[model samples]
Target chain A: MKLVRIFFKAVTMELSRRMAYKADFIIRCFILVINSIISPIFALILYTTTPGIPGWKFEEFILFQGTLIFVFGFTHAFFWQLLSFTIYEVRKGSFDRFLLLPYKPLSYLTASSIETDGFSEMFTGIIIIWWAFKKLGLSIFSANFILYIYLVFLALVFHYSLNIITASFSLIFIRSWALMDILSSLVIFAKYPASIYHIGMVFFFTFIFPIAISAHYPVQALLSAVSYKLILFLTLSVSLFFYLSISLWNFGLKKYKSAGG
Target chain B: MKKYRELTKIGAKIALAYKFDFIVSIFTVPISIIVFYFLWKTIYAYSGLDVIRGYTFEEMVNYFIMSMVIALLGWSNIERVVEYDVLYGEMVLRLLSPVTYLASLFYTEMGLKAMSLLVEATPIFLIGIVFFKAKVFSILNLILYAIAVLFSIGLVFLISFLIGLSSFWLKRISGISRSKKLFLSFLGGGFVPLTFFPKIFQQISEWLPFQYIRYVPINIYLGKYSTFLALEMIGRQIIWIILLYIIAKILWNRAIRKFCGVGV
Candidate 1:
């Protein structure tokens, strides 16, 4: 309950800050919207030349991209920004300020910052998903809706796990944020259906990397309708990746070398 | 000129000290190439089309590889340097140090870029040539690409300097920096080839200056343009350089006058 209260307090503080910079926020959010537009348009253009990614229709691919944007919105707005702050503080030898906190550092590290600009992506994602849904002839009342929502959340968690794993490396390696930044850009690879990838790629994304849960698997479930069997696989992969990430995070914390006070 | 050379030497030395980080950063290049490679392969396979927008699959991949490499060459954190120094009045130290601040900062940034080129770019290119059999440019085209690349880097620096000057007014320029980067990527065709863009976007981007930074140079290397066209593109790049350089000079003066030395 205390940690929950702290998390909410952090969120409230971020909300207040967002309001204080309303003009700047609007400009950035608008720019981000403009930037994200290129991807879906690129997808559309690729589809124009060919059927696009083997089994995927243009709408289905849009759905995939939308789901990715949605998941990225959450990570971009919440987890990733805080991780960046942690990197900066660590490098400046000022991270001891956080380590001195009464509460667990991870709680503050993960939630204290918010990137309101990503709300633009969320809006864009909603539109894309809505369009995709209309094109695919799905509705809120569809049984697959519940499963799709569940899987999308699972994907978000998986993405969060990836960020945690990346952030954890900061404990051992100085300036590891560069590596994390590179890994983050790899999200572009997941925007299209995995069906287009080689068999090895599909397997790698499914298990080894597990970014598929974020966009690819969710779209697959929505289009094909979910089955209990597929949920089992999804649950397994998400759980494994999440569990590993948490373990690494804990190990990194123990390995961490404190900087100047 | 001697002072500038000394400052550049210091910049290059500082960059060399972080040699490992520079080398490690380039791993992203290969990762990007692989991802784009797969994406295009799937697109081509699904379309069952050899040429889309007048690009063969090989040419498309080669285009991206070259574009990304060019981008890495042109990349500089002019905003971070200018913003931090201008806001913190760290520029005062440069003034006291008896060196041209602009020359010193540019040298430092270029030093990092040059290191990246040697450590990250050249090797990737060599490997790409053997592995991807990346675009075989004519000698004339290669010479033209070299010229284009020089102008492109200069133009990119000017544009970035102009953006960086905004920090004098807006202390928190995270939004501006992000906006600038995204706009540059979109306009420069970093995300996708301009050829693949809808005709309207292509037309609009052509009116803008970013295409010279990545698209034009890569095209010259891929031999996508005629000698005449290559010359024309390179000419545009030179024009942008002159145009942006003038704008940057004006902005820099105003930004300095407006500076309040908030942190200092």
Candidate 2:
């Protein structure tokens, strides 16, 4: 409970700081909202031309896209600043200040900066998801729905783990920014159905990089096409990736030669 | 003319210093191209049609390869310029430069993009020839296409410069820059051919400068347009370039005035 309170307090303080730049905050949120809307407009255009994409119907595709957006929105809203923290802190040699503190450095780094503007994307995602469900006539209270939600939570873990691993590269490389850009583009690939790729490509995304688990697994679970074996595989993969990322992060930290002033 | 030559030469030399980044960008191109290849292949497989929107599977692949090259060559990292200038107040020096700041920046970007394109596009083009059995163009056609590509770069540079200039008024312009990039990709037929869009949207997109940056040039390269038609398209690009250049100039002037008044 104490830890929870401290986390909330940190988030509140970051939010207040962001709110101080009220005009910028509001404009940023508006831009994000418009950006989110544009994706659906494209999807609508596609639906109009074709009855549905192969394997997945138009509504289901919308659901998949919405879920991916929702995950992105949630992650970016809460942890967007985490993406730049390592680079900025390492470059400024201000990371030592965190090292001087008693609490976990990673936790403090994560809580240092929060972008409230990202909340607009999160809100837009929720609306999109709701629209998809309503259009598909899917019952939100069903057992399958619960499973889908669980899978999405797991996918979020996989996504966050990948980002954390990429961001930790800042400890060694000054130009680690491109790594994040590459990873983000890789994540955008997941916005589409994964069955589109060959089985070999699926294996590559699942075992090699784990981009498949980011969206494909959750959408598969929701569609009820994914077997229990696959679900178990995906869950274990998420855990393994997170474990690997944490280990890699710690290893990279030791390699850090604090940027010379 | 002498000044332009000197500027271009200087720009080319500075870009050559970043050999590591140039090499890294080469690898990134294949990742996106591979993704799009499989994506379109899957779509075609599901449709059970060999052609869509007047493009065969072979032609679509060719179009995308061309689009990838065009996009890479024309892409502007103007947001970095904006962030650096705004945060460090280095834009003051830029304003003081006697030559047009936009021209100097565009020249530097063009040099860097040209080098990166050569490094990246050579491999992709080779693979494309092997896989798609791509056809060769005549010398005249190649020359015309090169001119189109340069104009496309000029058009993209202007658009990106305008977006960066907006940072003078808006605090966080990265999102705006991102959206503009995505918008161009969509409207410019970088993702899929603009012909696939509905008639109304397709017509609307034609008037937009985005199509001139990627779609028209690739189409000309693929022999999709006649000699006269290609010339007409290039003519249109020149007009858009002039229009955007005027807008960017006006915006820069206003932004500088605002900055001076506010003492930023």
Superposed on all Cα atoms, the candidates' RMSDs to the truth, in angstroms, are 2.6, 2.8
Question: B1-264, model 1: which lDDT tens digit per residue?
Answer: 777666667767877887766676456677677778888887777678788888898988888877777777887678877878876788777667775566677776666767777887787787678766685668898889878988887877888887777767766566777767667766887877788777887898888898888888988988989999999888888888878877877877777777766552
Compute each candidate's TM-score over C-alphas. 0.92, 0.90
Docking band of candidate 1: medium
In candidate 2, what are the lDDT values of residues B139-210, reduced to their tens digit? Answer: 666677889998998888888888788777775565666677777887888877788788998788877898
Q: After superposition, how far is residue A190 of candidate 2 from its true place, in Å?
A: 1.4
The number of the candidate with the highest DockQ is 1
The reply for model 2, stretches above 4 Å from the true place, is: A1-6, A9-21, A259-261, B1-6, B13-18, B79-89, B121-124, B127-140, B168-172, B251-263
Give one digit per residue, the lDDT tens place, for model 1 in A1-261. 676676678777877776665555666777788777777887887777566677777888888888888888878887877677767776776777877888677777775766676778888888888988888888889777878898988988888888777777776575665766576667766766776677998888887787778888887777886678868877888889999988987887787776622
The DockQ scores of all candidates, in the order shown, are 0.51, 0.41
**After aligning candidate 2 to the native by TM-score, how far in Å is the CA of A70 from where it should be?**
1.1
Alpha-carbon RMSD, candidate 2? 2.8
In candidate 1, position A226 carries an lDDT of 63
Candidate 2: tens digits of C-alpha lDDT, residues A1-261: 444666688679867776665665666678788888876777776667544467788778777778777888877866667767876777677767767776676776665546666678878888988998888788778777777888888877887787678767877675665676677767766767777778887887776667776556777676675677877877788899889988888887787767623
**Measured with DockQ on alpha carbons, how good is candidate 2?**
0.41
